[model samples]
Target: MNQTKKYLVVGLGRSGVSAAEALLRYGAEVSVYDKKTQDEIEAPLVNYLKTQQVTCYLGTDPSDLGRYDAIVVSPGVPLDLPFLQKAKTLDVEIIGELELAYRLGKGNYIAITGTNGKTTTTTLVGEIFKNAKRKTAVVGNIGIAVTSTALVAQDDSWLVTECSSFQLETTEKFHPVVCALLNITPDHLDRHKTLENYAKAKAKVFKNQTEKDFFVVNYDDPVAYHLIQECRSTIIPFSRKSILEKGVFVKDNRIIVKDQSQNEIDICGVDELVIPGQHNLENALAACGIAYFCGISAEMISKTLREFQGVEHRLEFCAEVGGVRFVNDSKGTNPDASIKAIEAMKGNIVLIAGGYDKNSKFDEFIQAFDGKVKALVLLGATAPKIRETAERFGYQTIFDEKDMGECVKRSFSLAEPGDTVLLSPACASWDMYSSYEQRGKHFKSCVQELER
Candidate 1:
């Protein structure tokens, strides 16, 4: 936080750029480094940073680790990299864009983190905040870098941030007034290296939260709930299962928030929510818990839940052709997430899956089908592995396609009337696309083309 200290930003992505810009604006000496070359990473932000005379080390490693006071790393940059390890050895501070933003910004943050439903919950939280007439900004892994909004955040503002495990990993003194952990499942194991390590990263979201602050937790998830046992925050829980004496939960088809006195405030009916899936119901519960603890009205929370159309690429309806409906769930980039997507659909699904593997096992995902999935269409790097898993499970009706277009066409052909052509890849899209957004957009376009 010292204005005169020098800072280094690793990675040239959005978070990296925002961190670099924020440091410059804080009157600190700033430098940037990325494994990608200059031409490989270019945007108005990158060009603007160059105009600021910011030092950039592109397509190369930093030679000296001791020059900068701290390194602000992007979520994608591995902290175990050689130079980063060297920096750690020299006693240099290492933090992420989220930490930097927390230090620089002035706001009450409702930080949401989990293996799945983060985007949906964060979006719902933002909507609830907006409905309450609070000054709010939606940032972090929901797409906008938190640092980009850091300077403008006032003390009265609310930053409804979507914190990823990667962002949470580097947090130091990054505290949110309301922190929610939706659920933790096997995800990003390729980066974190283990499920418990991944859970540890998620557990950091509530690390700095004081008892005065509220920590929203998923009581139904044993893995996530166990980690919160040592948390210092005033715990607020939401569950799809047992009825709690306090916090938000569903009972008799209604979303209810109970106080210490066992008084309940009815939010809305479960069937009234615009988004689908039991997972989404959990997301709504978490959001409601966060908003209620933050002083948002039950009416506003219920209204927002009823009106939320859901974020794009997450169970989004694309088109219907020849009685076959197409759904885009590109955000289902892990097995646990795809399983939720599968459970949300109605009719028999001809599913298009497979992408970049994150060391995820597809056994649970495949088993979730339970005769609901009619056929499988595979693509991307994880295609072979997924196909093997599917065959071993006795779901042999599968077709391996070279690309998204072929996969979409094949899935549509395999679907009968009243069936859903669902693109719910249980792997990340890095092997075939820059991001899940790019992959989802491509799937939607291919489906739209079918109508043409």
Candidate 2:
């Protein structure tokens, strides 16, 4: 409860740097440390830290962390690290950057967390609030760090945060007035060690909430649904399969969002959603639930849904050339997500997939193919695995490449008129790219080069 707390920021990545800067602005003694050197933390804004008199210990000794009263860890850093253990022994409170931001934010929040669709739901909810003329800010894992946004929060503003399991893992007293726990899936298992652990991490968003808070959850998701039974907060359930008279539900193609008083509003029909796939319909449902609960009108919600442009790198259409439509869905990092992307495609598809395999089961992809995929263009470390799966499934047309450019060139070669060329890699892009953004940009670059 110190007014001018000494904060130690671990992991100088996007979240880490933003949190450090915010702490300094608040008159807190800020120091940062990371395993990487100054050159490795290549953010241009991080260089400004030195001018602001912020202490930086990049690629330095762990002993430096022992001096701070509290530690704000980056989401990427492992919770079981030796430095974290040392900090705990010394009674230094260790928390994530989101937790720090939550403590600083004066406005009420609508926090969204899940394995997938968090960004979509968060963005949609923010848009609804925006259309209603509410002062709202969308931050968290989607891009802008919450800490910086909180510093400029107004009395009428609302924080619509998209939190990841990594951010939720270290949260303390970061309760949202209205929390949305979207569908939980088997993702980031490499970091969480198990599916159960990942679910537990996501559930932490509502762990400390009181009766005044509300939790919006998907009743169709087993893990998420079961967790709701254990939550102390008031629960409002939603589903794509069932009809809920008192909560958000789908009935005859239209999404009906109902409150406790049985008052209802139809935001839009599933067929009207600009974004494709059943998963996106579900995302829209979750967003409508969040927006309606936050007091956004039905009219504004409908208008925003009609005008909302879908998130980039997730089943986004690039262009049509020579009657071949190109899609960039580099955000599909798991087999389930990839399956959804494929299911959303029209006509014959030349799929460009494969990256760093995390030992996920490709059986879903194999079964979902059902002759829809005209040709399979594989790349990165998981090319062999994808090829093996395709071969095992008796898929006749399969091509392997080392990188994105080769995959695009080969896919174009095999594609005919009315065929879709999709870059929906069901694996992490770390093998050949920095992140999914790089993978998506590279795919677009190759497609443009081919056009030229």
Candidate 3:
């Protein structure tokens, strides 16, 4: 945080802009770069940066890269880019936005990372800390930029951050007082390229932590359980199945936590949670474990668990039309996430699946269909790929839809009374929609139209 240090922020995204602003605020010379041209960037942000006197490099490689002391990279920028590779050779000291926030921010941090339940767990932990009267800020992949929040963070502030594999990749000294790896599954394979590499990136959340720090991990997930061997922090394992001598687990339908002191405390009943799904129960456990390590009381954690309705786009209830219920699980952008959504439902399901293929295989997703998925309504680039997988399983009830509206309508037609029409695309929404939120909203609108 030296006043005269020069910093280069790569990418003009939210994280990039926030990093640049934070560096400038700390009295550092800042330069911004993005692949997009000046016309492609937002006017307000462009004008705002101008007022700060930060140099902007658009549609080209940053000039005089060797002059900067450090380069802060946004999560979306690929590390293998030729310019970045060249920068690495020059020993420019590349770090991610999370690392930048960590270096400049003063606060206790609780970071959560996983393939499926990061947002739900991070949000739950944030709520639990707030319920305990702690000054908490929820940031990172959940939405808010950590750099922006970190700038104003007081000494007593708790930064509950949701870290993704991409963000974790470039981190070096980004340690959290409390960290959790909810569950590791095959996701972002197109980016990380391999499962081992992805898990290693996620394991970075605990890389800098000492024995004084606490690390929460999923005992149920073999991939996550394996990471325990690599972590340096005090391990707290959470499981939906089996009793644990340490960490959080469920017993006789109640959430139980066995602290570091060997004192077991009953947090809440499984029935008390407003959110459905065993996966959510696991999320709740991970959140509770984090909160417990942070000194939040069990009563406060339980209260938050019982009242928190769950995050949007994760098995969110859309509406009921003609006795068929519609659920939006657009957040299930990966096979494992969609599998959890399918397992959470009660009645027969007319599943609307498929989207932009991330080079992921769908055999496991197709196998999960079993008896619950009465009919499959497919769409987007992955439709044909999913159909092939479904046929391999000898499951034949399938409908190919051209759009989200039609996908919903087709799912409804295939659904009977007491059946659930679930929009749990096992792929990302980028094929047709900008994000999963937009896709979920459009699905809700289509369902609402059916009600009319």
Please report, in order, the local distance difference test score of every candidate based on alpha carbons. 0.92, 0.86, 0.91
Candidate 2 — what's its lDDT? Answer: 0.86
List the candidate 2 regions with Cα displacement exceeding 4 Å.
1-4, 39-47
Candidate 2, residue 434: the lDDT equals 76
Q: How well does each candidate superpose onto the true structure, as a TM-score?
A: 0.98, 0.95, 0.97
Would you list the clashing residue pairs of candidate 1?
none
Using TM-score as the measure, name the better of candidate 1 and candidate 2.
1
- The candidate scoring highest on lDDT is 1
lDDT of 3 by residue, 216-321 (tens): 9999999989988988889999999999999999999999999878999999999999999989999999998999888888888888898998999998997889
Expressed as tens digits, the lDDT of each residue in 252-332 for candidate 2 is 889898888887777787778898888888888888878877778888888888788888899999988888999999989
Backbone clashes in candidate 3 total 0
Q: How would you order the candidates by lDDT, starting with the best?
A: 1, 3, 2
Considering TM-score, where higher is better, how would the candidates rank from best to worst?
1, 3, 2
lDDT of 1 by residue, 1-452 (tens): 68889889999788988888888888998889999787777666568878888887888888777988999999998889999999999999999999999999888888999999999999989988998899999999999999988779998999999999999999999999999999999999999999989999999999988989999999999999998787998989899888998999989999999975778999999999989989999999999899988988889998999999999999999999999999999999999999999999998999999999899999999899999999999999998899898899888998999999999889988998899999999999999999999999999999989999
List the lowest-lDDT window of 10 residues for candidate 1. Answer: 37-46
Clashes of each: 0, 0, 0
For residue 140, give model 3's deviation from the true position in Å. 0.7
